[model samples]
Target: MKKNNSFTIRKLTLLIPGIVVAILTLQSCQEDETTELTRDEEIAITENATFSEDVSDEDIEIANSAEIEAGIQEPASRESSSEKCYATTWDAATRILTIDFGEGCVGPYGRQRRGKIIVSYGEEGNYYVADRTITFDNYFVNGNQITGELYVEKAVINEEGFYENNYTVNYTILFNGGTTFTLNGSRKREWIAGVLDDNFANNVFRITGSLTGISTRGISWSHQIVEPIIADFNCRSEGNFLYTQGIKEISYSNSRRKRTRTVDYGDGICDRSYTIAINNDLITITAE
Candidate 1:
C-alpha cells in the first residue's frame, strides 16, 4: 500500500509539468495572434487612408479651377498634365458647379475616373470661404466606386494670414474586388505656401485629420494624424498623388486581438516610400 501511494504521487507530479507547458504554449500563441499585425492589414489601412486624401485633393483642385473659370476668383495657372476629359458647368443662379467626367478619364495621378462631382455653394465666392457641399454622382475612381459627401466649412485666416479650410468627410469605398470600407472623418487643410502666387501646382498645404472605419475583413480601425502631413502638389512622386511627408498612427482591432502601428512617410522626401512599424518590426513599402 505504501509503494502504491508513492507511485501515485510521482505520477501526479509528472503530469503537472506537462499541463503547465501546454498552458504556456497556448498563451504564447494567443499573444502572437492578437498582437502581431499582418502585412496585408497594414497595407489595407494605409491604402484606405490614402484613398480619402486622394479624393479630397481632386475635389479641391476641381473646385478651385471651377471658381477661377467661373470668374469668381482670379485665374490661376492651370498647368496640369492630367488628360482633360471632363466638362465643367456653373450655374450662377443656382450656385452649383458640376464637373462631368464623361465615360472615363485618366486623372492627374494616373487614376481612371468616370462620373460627376456636384459642388453646391451658398453664394458666389471662392471655395475657401463659401459654405459648400460636395457630392458624387455615379463616381468610379480607378474602377472602385466611391460614394460620399464632403462638407466644406467656412475658411478662417490664421495668424500667418493663410486660409485654413476644414472639411467633414463621410465616404464609402467599394473596391473592385467587392470588399468595402466605410470611412468617416474630418480634415483640416492649412494653406501654408503659394497662396499669394496663385499657382495651383506650387500650392502647399498642411493637412491634419482623423478617420474611423470598418473594413470588409471585419477589422475596425482608426487613424490619427500625429504629425501634420505636408502635401506639395509640385513635388510629384511616382505613383503617389500628394502627401509628401508626415506621420500617422493607426489602431486596429479584430476578433482575436487589438494592435497599433505607426506609418512614417519619410522626412519630407519626394518618393513613394513609407514605413510601417508594428510589433517592433519595420517594413518599407513603395506605393504602386
Candidate 2:
C-alpha cells in the first residue's frame, strides 16, 4: 500500500508542472497578440495622415464666384492671330451671323457662317407679293455700321453649333408664300480690304486656328468651359495675303476629354453641303 501511494504522488507532481507550463505559454501568446495589435495601429496611423487647408468654407465660395465670371479658367491656348491679321464688316448683322472659319475663307456659299433677320410675308395669292429671309455671311466693322451681304434664300434651320448659330440650312430659296422665286447657292469669294494686303483672298499663309472651341462646353450659356482653340489652317490665298484664325474652345465634352477637331470646309457657303474623305480622316464641307 505505501509503495502505490508513493507512485501516485510522483505522478501528481509531474502533472502539476505541465499545467503551470501551459498557463505560462497561454499568457505569452496573449501578450504577443496585444503587441501585434499596437504595432498595426501605429503603422496605420503613420502611413495614412490627412492634411487639410486652413481656409474656411465662406472663402472658398467667394473665390469660386469671382472665377465664374472670367473665361481665363482656360487650360490651353490656340491663338493663331499672331501670324495673321483680320477685320470685320459691321452691320446690325454681325451679331446674327455664325462664322465658320475655313468655310468662310473661300467665302462662297458653302456652309452657313452667320444667321440674320428674315422678313417673311404671306397672305393669300397672286399679286406677286414676297418677303425675305435675311442671312449675314460676312461683315466689316466700318466707321458706324458693320456691313455684309444677306444670304437671301429659302432656308430651314438645322442644327445649332457652339454659338447660338444654326448649322444646317436649306440651300434652295423657294418662296411658296406667293410668286415663287428660286435662288441658287453661289460662292462669293470677296477679298476684304486692308487685311494683310489688297489681294488677301489669294494669299496662302497657314490655317493655324479653329472656329468651334469656346462653345463646346454647352451652348445653353450655362455650362461652359473657356478653353481656347489652337489650330492653324495654314495655307496661301491668291495674293499671298497672310490669313490665320485663332479659335478658343470653352465647352465640355461627354468623353470628358476636351477635343479640338474641325468641321468646316474652306469654302464659305451657308447652304452648301460637303463630302467626307475616305482615308483623309478630315471633314470636307462643300456647296453641292
Candidate 3:
C-alpha cells in the first residue's frame, strides 16, 4: 500500500510539471496574437493617413518654396545662352516624348549638367491628362551623375486650369567621390499663376513631398514636409530663394542609432538659412 501511494505521488509530480508547461505555452501563443494584432492596427492607421490631413499649411508653403529654389520645375536650357536648347521629340509609335539635352546643356536650376529625359504616356492626345513615366539617363546633378526613373501618377487638371502632378521619384546619384545615394519619394507639384510664361524672374512655384535616401556611407535620411515649400523668384532679390519646413529623420549603424528633427525655413522671409530642432536642442544651418 505504501509503495502504491509512493507511485501515485510520483505520477502527480510529473503531471503537475506538464500542466505548468502547457499553461505557459498557451499564454505565449496568446501574447503573440496580441502583439500581431497591435502591429496590424498600427499599420492600418498609417495606411489611412493622408498628407493633407497630417501636414500643416506652413510646412507645405515652405516645401514649395524650397522646391522652387532647388529648380526642380525649371526645364533644361542651354548652358551658354538664354535660348532653350533641349529638343523635345514625340514618337507616335511608342507614345513617348524624348527630351534630349544637347551637348553643354544644363538643367533648369543649373544643377544638372547633361542628361536626357524620356517621358512615356498612356495616351497620345493629351500628355498632362494621362499617367506618365519619366526616365533619366546620365542625369547630372550637383556634379553627380544620376540615373533611374520617376513617374507621374494620378495627375489632374484643376478647374482653374492648373496641372497637379503627383510624382513618384526614384534615382541613384553617383557622386564625384564614387559614393552613391539612392533617393525615393512622392511629391506634388502645382504651377503658380503667371509663372509658366516667359517671365523667369517672376516665376513662383510650390512643391510638397516626402523623400528618403540611403547613402553609401551607411547613413539613411528621410524628410517629410509638413507644409508645401514655396519658391518665389522674387525672393531671390532678397538673397534667399529656397524656403523649407519639414521633419528630418536620420538613422545610422543599421538603425542602431537614430535622430529626428524639425527643420524650419526662416520666418516667412527669404534667407539662405534654416533651423533644425531636436527635442529642445536647436541648430541653425546656413548655406555656404
User: Over all chains combined, what TM-score does candidate 3 have?
Assistant: 0.59
Looking at model 1, how many pairs of residues clash? 0
**Residues 97-203, candidate 2, lDDT per residue (tens digit)?**
12223222222211122222222222221001111233333321111111222222222322431111111112212112321111122211111222232221222
Residues 1-288, model 1: lDDT tens digits: 246888889999999999999999999888767555566876777777666666666676666755665555544443333345678888878888888877999754566888988888976465677889988999888888888888888789988888998888888888899998888888898989877564466678898989898866757888899999888776642455476789989888766676778988778767766788867788887654
Better of 1 and 3 by TM-score: 1
Candidate 2 minimal-lDDT segment of 10 residues = 49-58
* Per-prediction TM-score to the true structure, in the order listed: 0.82, 0.18, 0.59
lDDT of each: 0.76, 0.24, 0.51
Alpha carbon deviation, residue 118, candidate 1 (Å) = 0.8
Candidate 1 RMSD to the correct structure: 4.6
lDDT of 1 at 165: 82
Q: What is the alpha-carbon lDDT of model 2 when measured against the actual structure?
A: 0.24
Q: Regarding lDDT, does 1 or 2 come out ahead?
A: 1
